[model samples]
Target: MNRLYHESEDWVAQGSCRQYDPELFFPVSTTGPGLHDAELAKAICRGCAVRRECLQWALRAGEPHGVWGGTTPEDRRYMRRDLPLPAAS
Candidate 1:
């Protein structure tokens, strides 16, 4: 994938991302299914607080799995290519 997975020390929870949910057992639901799950992931992301931060981290670091904040790896790919990426926090 186009994601760059790396850790960020400045990850502020602009909102809740399932990425860090200890209660989460399985990967975000998009791994197996097609973009259907990606759409679902986006819906779940609707209320996320740190969605931007998570997206930036993913784009800058090329995160590859699960949902970051709210957006998926594919979403990050589009955003990174389309929008101006934020600096690492």
Candidate 2:
């Protein structure tokens, strides 16, 4: 799939989550205790310099799970509703 940003931009390398456990961004559930993990992930994202790039990438890729760009899968679903469809290659 095409990326929303150039590879050389390397935004992923700058995410605040880089210093945390990868599992923290992939909560088992969005409810109950899993919600706590999600919140923690969001806290990290809040301070990330590449947050907008990460979120736009996730939305363009139709990411279906995990916390991305400080947003849950459900959150992206709602956000995707108003996005323009990507052009066919």
Model 1 regions lying over 4 Å from their true place: 1-15, 18-37, 83-89
lDDT of 1 by residue, 19-47 (tens): 53432312445455444555555555666
- Candidate 2 local Cα displacement, residue 62, angstroms: 0.5
Error of 2 at 55 (Å): 0.1
Give lDDT tens digits, candidate 2, residues 1-89: 11224345568667777678878888998778798888888788888898899898888989887888888887888787876533322
Question: TM-scores of all models?
Answer: 0.50, 0.80
Model 1, residue 74: distance off in Å is: 1.8
Model 2 poorest ten-residue lDDT run:
1-10
- Residue 9's lDDT within candidate 2 is 50
Candidate 2 collision pairs: none
Would you list the clashing residue pairs of candidate 1? 3-62, 4-61, 4-62, 4-63, 5-62, 5-63, 14-49, 14-50, 15-49, 15-50
Model 1 TM-score, all chains together = 0.50
lDDT of 2: 0.76
Q: Give the clash total for candidate 1.
A: 10
The lDDT per prediction is: 0.53, 0.76
